[model samples]
Target chain A: MKEFLVISGKGGTGKTSITAGFAALAGDIVLADCDVDAANLHMLLEPVTYHTEEFIGSRKATIDPTHCSNCRLCQESCRFNAITSTEIACTVNPLSCEGCGVCSFVCPKGAITMHDHVSGHWFLSDTRYGPLVHARLGIAEENSGKLVAKVREQAQRIAQEKDVEYILVDGPPGTGCPVISSISGVDLALIVTEPTIAGLHDLERVRQLAGHFDVPVMVCINKYDLDEAYTRKIELYCQKQQIELAGRIPFDRNVVSALVRGIPAVAYAAPSTSENSAAKAIGDVWQAVRNRLLA
Target chain B: MLITIASGKGGTGKTTVAVNLALTLKELLPVVLLDCDVEEPNVHLFLQPVVNESEKVMTTVPKIDGNKCDGCGKCSEFCAFNAIAIVKGKPITFPELCHSCRGCTLVCPTGAITETPRQIGLVEKGTWSVIKTAKGTLKIGSPLAPMVVDAVRNTAPLHHGDQAVIIDASPGTSCAVVAAAKDTDFCLLVTEPTPFGLNDLTLAVELAKKLGLPHGVVINRAGLGDHSVYDYCHEADIPILMEIPFDTKYAACYARGGRLVEEFPDLSDRFLKLWDVIQHHAKRHQREEPKT
Candidate 1:
């Protein structure tokens, strides 16, 4: 099976819009949104969840008031400063806690207990296009990268079971742990970037990140007409790096309008619509990706 | 005084506020600017610091001695990050996943586990612009940014009576950001007015609370997104340090490699006054309770 992953260097770079187009165009694929922290792919796919499971990424320490006196050893042991001093109760700061469980081991009062907090939830669902795997990491929860990896693994397993030929994965922005988990073992990576200085700069960073894993990547300029000079610069970068430039879409208001309407630009504004130019440009991008992957 | 500019979301003008503030301070005193966005640091592009010297920084990696090799998966079992995996007879380690905590070597019963050096990235130093603002650039592949931040802090120029050190940190309240603001006296978080911006700014504020770093806010593209950011600041009792409007000309100059202090000469006096306010607040905060 030929798998394709899409990622962007920064937010609002039109990665989801283009990924939605590929989902609408591709057939018989397991679609997934690896950007669990800020996932919006479900807005377009309209995936009807068939399976849902709570994801407990890490353990949290809770003080059992009935257990014993507040010896304060657990509070002293917590490097995260999670334990409250005035309340006389040791509570884990959801954002501060790293799930190290050191407090449990260090508690002399034996009042501290570890509990599995439902950090987030993962979903396996049926979308209009096909089966979709999406997830939502809870507020102030750590281990987003791990949750992303789990969801991707589930998607890959489902794709393998059904003998699906493609897994269109919508990866996260940035070159952090989550992005690394998303791009690993993917056949092709579509790095969507803008035609701006920071756009090109972060593009090179993520591109190098993908290169470290030896993953083949292609470039897609989302707002090419915004800055022709930077777009040409990105093209040169792709050529110099031997990475293919898939295609470019001129800046259009219809793209955002289509998003607010909850539909892929290509389907909502195909060849016969006012957004025909933008839709056709996306078609050309898919054509290039197809020739690069299927050929 | 040490001031750090940070944000939770990217492209929210962390570097812009940082470089501009640093330049504005340069007119007041000797300024040192450290870019802690090691993942994909673009501050250098704006600061354009000339490379005075370069040094390679490395992280501790596990070294397996083949002669002392016992193919036991003890190290793999002890790894919390799933970095160490024993496939068949050979043990494999993913560098990106390793947190360099040396847990594997501690758990390995056999003498096979040893410390080895792995160069994650570089910490290069020079001066930013003609004003000689000290700066650093972290390469892309190097994941050990916190280490570099610590290193920079160790060697960071002091405030020197009247001078102040301003740090431009990476987005997100991760270990890297913590490392960047380790010993900072105060911090200013730059953010736009958006849902993502608010979410991240609140998270960053929580981080500052944990770290006990007195901080304020700098609202970039202030009027574009929403006023909820203002409401959030008021509710949290955090001061709005500075506000840069959604001026297309300013953004265009920033995009075209024009320094804000250079374009808006009036900003220099404003930033100087900002420094005075920060100094007063930091002093008042520190003096709130005298240490016995």
Candidate 2:
């Protein structure tokens, strides 16, 4: 199966929206919503989960106060500064802990113990478009990158089991761990950006990251008319970088309207409905992506 | 006061709100803007801060001493991150996977393991207009954004009672956002009025509540979606601090990195008013928090 990921280094650049559009257009696809922290593609796909697994992505250190000694060794040894001396005993701040197990290992009293942290849950579900593998990381949870990796692995497994041709992934914002997990090893990464300086800046970072992973990339500028000057700048950047420009999608209120209706813009506003709708532009972008992916 | 601008969803104007709020507050106080979104630090683009200082944020990775002669597998077995593994009777380390816990060094029976600093990101400090700005940029392929965020947060004297530090946190309620929200006096959760925005706003609110932060909401693009976001705030007792109406002209201006307060001076009053509400709620919450 060919895995195609839609990512934007910056948030809110229409990664999920565009990925959902691809889901609607692609044949024999397994959708993977790797934006586990703030997953929005499930809202559009209407997934009815058939399988769910609790993801123990990492471990958290906890202190057994009954056997504790006030040596402060765990506090000093901790690189994360997650351990602190409370009035009663030394405590582990769950949020600050990186679950490295050093505190547990170095504790003189053996008071600190490492336990599996139920960081998130991944789901295998049936959607109108196809099968979807998505996840929801617990609130204020760490290890989102691991959860994303789990989702991708499960999606790829399902794709292989069902002989699916394409794995369309909706990635999170930022070039952080989760973005890396989602975009790395993909057959193609379609970076969704906008005609803003912020967009251009973040696009460079994402492009560099894609290059770091040796992942092939194509750029698609959303809201191309918002700033024609910056749009030209982005076009120039693409030209200089030798990256393919898939297409430019116009800013359309209908996209949000479609989102409110819980449907893809292409499905909500068919290409035949209007000559210059965002839906038409999306269809063209998909065709471009498909042609390149199949090539 | 330390105020964090964050959102659960991306592209909801966290940087816009942060930059403009700092610029507006700079007129009345010494304001600092720290962009903690290391993976994609965008505030620097809009602020145009001429960075005068740069510091490398480093984490320790094991440096194996091959001459120590014995390749006991104990270090590999003791590593929690699987960053070290016994390869060809030797311990091989993957620095990217290391959490800098120093566990492997302690577990090495042959005393072959040592620690070395690896740069994961960079912290840049500079000034833009009257605002002191600092930002963190993670090395392209590194995953240690939270570490960089902590470094950026420490670049300024955040404890000055008379100073205002505005932190533009990364989107989503994850580790990076958690690092930015730490020790903040208040959090301004920015969101738009849409299903996706509301869905993620609820998550961001949950994170704020979990952190026990005094937070309020700013509704950007108020006229774009529906009343669900407003209803969520009303139901949750989150004060709606400010509202920037949906205007294409403002959006276009922002696209070119134009400051709202500079392009339209009338908006400064709105941000100032936003500060007023934030001050009122933040102080009230602070006073009540001590008792809890």
Candidate 3:
């Protein structure tokens, strides 16, 4: 089985919309939303969750007040400054803690202990298209990369159990840890970019990240008509890099309407002819992607 | 006051709101715009500032001395990130995966481990007219974005009595956003009107609440989607700070790396109004907090 990840280096470049459209077109596929920090594919897929699990991705240091004697050693030893000392006692800030266990080790009184924090929840669900695996990380939570990895692992397991041929992953934005976790080991990464300077700049960053992981990459310019020149520039960059240009989707209000309606563009009823529709372009992109995956 | 513009969802106009607000407020106050979206800094693209100073942001990682090494594997055992490995009784360090926590050096039985500076990113300070601008650019393939973000925030000039700092945070409520939002007086969350927007906005609101930071929402692309985001805000008692209508003109200007206020001069008043609302909300929230 092959996994195809749809990602954009910058946010709001239509990664989820394009991934949702591909899910609508691709058959025998399991869907995974690895953007655990902001999992939006569930809004489009409307999955009915069959299984749920708490994601204890990391540990948070906690101070036991009962053990008393505030030496403030943990606070001084913590590199993340997660421990705060006041007149009464020292406390741990969960948001700032990296769960590195340095504070607990350095505590003379053995008051600080690492406790497993339930940072998020992962779900296995059934959608209109196929089985789906997704997650929701708690607000201000770290370990999103770990949660994403868990979501993808479950998605791949379900795909294997169901004998599915592909796993379509909706990855998070940026070239950060979560994006790295989502794209790593995937068969192909489909980078959805726009025709803007920010788009081009971020595309290069994510492309470089993909190269670091030795993963093959494909490019698609969403809202290509926004700036013809930038789109041409992106085309040239992709050509020079020997990356496949899977599709160029024109800016379409229908894509927004489809999102507002909480459905994939390919599944939405287009008010006008499909000739110039962004959904049609997405379909062609999916076809190209499927051909490449199969080949 | 330090105000951070953030969104849990990407492409929600965080940078657009931040840049426009900074440009508009520079007329009334000393404004410093810190682009803390280190992984994908874009405010510079729109502002086009003339960078006057650039500094490298470095993080320390453990460098094991091979000659002094009697690798008991203690360093590898103590490393939380698994950045150290003992092969053939020799400690190998993977600086890329290191979190710079100094745990390995402390845990090493021998005096073999030493801390060394590794460049993670760069922070540049510049000016666009009267508005001071600073941004952090993470090195390609580096995963330590929060470190860079903190460096950018640290580079901001000391806040005077009348100075206002506007931080443009990266999308998502991760460590990077936390680093950017830390110590900010208020956060302005930019979102849209769709379900996805509402879902992520809720997460961002929770983040603000957890951080104990006063925050308001600015709904971008207001007409393109449902009223869910507004409904969520109203139900949650979070103030709706502003609403930027979905206009092709604004989109076109943004596509061309142009500022919203510059392209449409009429939007200046709106951004200024946004500043007023933010100040009022921040003041009221601070007053409501009981004295310790």
Give one clash count per candidate, in the order shown.
Answer: 1, 1, 0
**A100: Cα error in model 2, Å:** 1.2
Candidate with maximal lDDT:
2
Residue range B87-170, candidate 2, lDDT tens digits: 898777889878898998887777888999999999999998889989899999998889899999999794768998899999
Over 4 Å off, model 2:
A270-272
Rank by DockQ (best first): 2, 3, 1
Candidate 1 lDDT score at position A158: 92
From the highest lDDT down, the ranking of the candidates is 2, 3, 1
TM-score of each: 0.77, 0.98, 0.96
From the highest TM-score down, the ranking of the candidates is 2, 3, 1
Candidate 2's DockQ is 0.86
When 1 and 2 are scored with lDDT, the better candidate is: 2
Q: What is the C-alpha lDDT of each candidate?
A: 0.74, 0.90, 0.89
lDDT score for residue B86 of model 1: 85
Q: Assess each model's interface with DockQ, reporting 2 decimals per model.
A: 0.18, 0.86, 0.73
iRMSD of prediction 1: 4.4
**What fraction of native interface contacts does model 3 preserve?**
0.73
- Which pairs of residues clash in candidate 3, taking residues 3 or more apart in a chain or in different chains? none
